[model samples]
Structure formats: structure tokens, C-alpha cells
Target: MPDWNLVGKQHVLAAIAECDRLGSRDFLQRYRFGRARASTVWHRGQEYDSKAILGVAYLHATGRAATADDFTRGEAGAVDLLQGLGFDVVVDEEALAAEKAPRVRKTTATKPARASRSAPAAKPRRTTAKSDERVKVCPTCYMALPATGICDNCD
Candidate 1:
């Protein structure tokens, strides 16, 4: 499963207040484009489009939109905001239902070929060991002993 991190409730409230005070232009410029683009902001703390998220939350609370669809960034913003805030929100059921209803499916199983009709078997792999060679090996370790009849590991 994917991991999620949510901002604390107190932090969210403070952020929302800041967003409300800033308004749309300020919110977009600060978060969506300008200083929000700074890597330090992400590394240090949270910086997101508060206005958009707040709108979504309102739509969700009011039930004006389906739960699943209601949580969009454009319409409700709250769901995303809540997600950012670490809330486990249920997906909008009606939107999910609508999406699931339109799915097109085709199921067909093909028969397998008969064993008698199969292709010939492939050859087996070969070992490098040769019968004619005086291959000396350590009896205890099953390792090839050197010409001096000494196994380095056994010694």
C-alpha cells in the first residue's frame, strides 16, 4: 500500500486562515507558482493551494457534489486538503458507481494444444567435468584439490 502523510488539525486551521487572508491572487502566486516553487519550502514545511482545497471541502460538506467527484481539486478541494491533513476520507460512492457502470468487458478462454501435437523437447545442459581427466577432489569438502593434493579451505 502507498504511504500518506497528513498535516495536523491545528496546522490546517492556521493554513486555512492564512489562505483566507491572502485571497486568490496571493494564494496562486505564493503557492501555485512563485515562492511555492522553492525546494526549501517543501523541505522545510507544507505549501499548497489552500483556496482550491477549501472550495472542495465546502462542496463535500454541503453534499452539492458526489463524494468521489466532490473531492476534486477544482470543485471541492477539501478532500485533497483532508488527504494532505492525514484524514482517511471515503471515496464518493455515486461517482465511483457511475464510473464502474460504463466499463466494457469481454471474457473468452481459448483451448490449450494437445500434448501429442506439441513440439519436440529441447536438449539438456552439459557439465564441464571430463571423465578422462585426473580430477583430484577433497573427499570431505567435495572441492577440487590442487595438484599438491591440498584443499586450501580444509587446511
Candidate 2:
């Protein structure tokens, strides 16, 4: 319940400057922030996790490290406050799309070789779906299929 009103434009700018000096990964790690999933801040053509910047800005203003659960995100939270504080905050469409996109593994099809009468009939190859990264289980049906994402059985 610390005051967000105390956080000024200078504090946010300072946080952004510090993030630039340390790089995003190191900065986020140092501040204990997870990767930004929905929103970001743009400064000098560089993208920054908006929530991280605000959290650190709160630190700069109040000398207290705010945890993730302390405040919410999205338009009604950091985005609105940052915009009011005169900083550029964006929706991060790329990140949103990536989160929404289905994660289907890409599988390659292998053709079976023909067996000859002169040789013993070849045993059917057993596929271990659990170990194969290229195989994916269809949510609709419990069957494993090529990672095409679309379950051919259901589709």
C-alpha cells in the first residue's frame, strides 16, 4: 500500500536508464521480475518490461522493493499510471500473440521400407510418444499424432 503518487517521471526515467545500463535480462534478474508477457515500455528504440520499470521506479522513489503480487498489470494498472506519469507504455502485441499461439511440436514423417519374402517379415516399429519431442497429444482425442497442431483424427 505504498504511495504510487510519490513515483514521479524522473524516478521512472532513472529506472529506464538503469535498465539500459544493465541490459534487460540482468536488470530483471537483479530486480526479481519475471519476463513481461503483456506490456512493455519503449525508450530510444529499446523495449523494456513495463512492470519491471515501474517496480524499480517505486524502489527509486520509496526505497522499498515491490513484489509482483503488490500491484496488477494491463491498461488499468501500470500502463495507465505510466502514461499519466508521461512515459510511453505499450500493449506489447508481439508478446500477447506469442502467449496466445498454440505450442505444437513439428514432426517429420518417416516411411517404412517394404519387406521381402526372402527375409523374415519386419516387425512393426514401436513409437515412443513420451520420448519423442516431435510428437504431440491431441487435446480433443488422447491419440498422438504428428505435431502439425491440427489433430487429424478430430479434424
Candidate 3:
């Protein structure tokens, strides 16, 4: 079976669980009914937008749509599918954070090698601008001229 990330799987399961709890038939229907009848759904006194809930439901449903692979062959609902197949879907926030954290490479400090006394110190090279280049300037206005050398405001 293919390995799945816990964070993604958890989000899918949460969406499915919410859908089941609300007795929603499908994602589209739920969204339409919520929009037309009730604009929002309250959970634990906190009001959540119906569209947001339906959006999450749709994502979970579509995410588990592909069953051609061996990992999710018989799965239907995101939550039921994983649970029915005996897949341990545990979401550890700390582990997920650790996984997302940038990896730092460890290295031992080394002493710098001394420069050879025989070789003379190299002088820094100075860069000089070429004086032969021609730059057109507007005669009417003392401003830098374009390719046509025509002043926009004066000419």
C-alpha cells in the first residue's frame, strides 16, 4: 500500500465526519441547500459559512475519488474508506511540524590555512567606465533623451 501523509488524511477525514454529522447527501447538494435555506451552520456556538463547509466536503470526496490504485481500491467515503480498510489515520501536529521544518546540516569547525609568505598580496582591480560612449540629451529640456532624442514635454 502507498504511504499517505497524516495531515492530509486528517483533513479529509474531518471533512467526511462533518458531512456525515450534518446528514448531507453530497457536496453540491449540501452547498446549494445551505446557500438557499441556511447561509451558515453553527457548531459549538461558532457559526461557520455553509459554502466553506461544502467546499471542504467536495475536496475530501474528490481527493478520495481515485480508487484505481491498490491503496484505495475499495474506499468510498474519505473517513469510512480509510477506517473500513483498517488504515491507522492518526494526525500528530508536532510530527507534522517537525517534518515541515527546514533541515539543517551539521559541520565541524575548521581552522583557516595560513597564506604562503613567498607570494605577494594581489592588488584589487579598479573598474573604469568607458568615455567613448555617446549619450543623447534633450536640447530644450536638460533631461536624458530617448532613442528618438525628442523631448516629451518641450518638443
Each prediction's TM-score against the native? Answer: 0.25, 0.57, 0.20
**120-149 per-residue lDDT for model 1 (tens digits):** 798998875321233344565433345688
The candidate maximizing lDDT is: 2
Per-model tally of clashing residue pairs: 10, 0, 0
Clashes of 1: 10
Model 2: ten consecutive residues of lowest lDDT: 129-138
RMSD of each: 24.5, 18.9, 25.1
Candidates in order have lDDT scores of 0.40, 0.70, 0.40
Off by over 4 Å in 1: 1-4, 33-155
For candidate 2, the per-residue lDDT at 143 reads 31
Output the TM-score of candidate 2. 0.57
Candidate number with greatest TM-score? 2
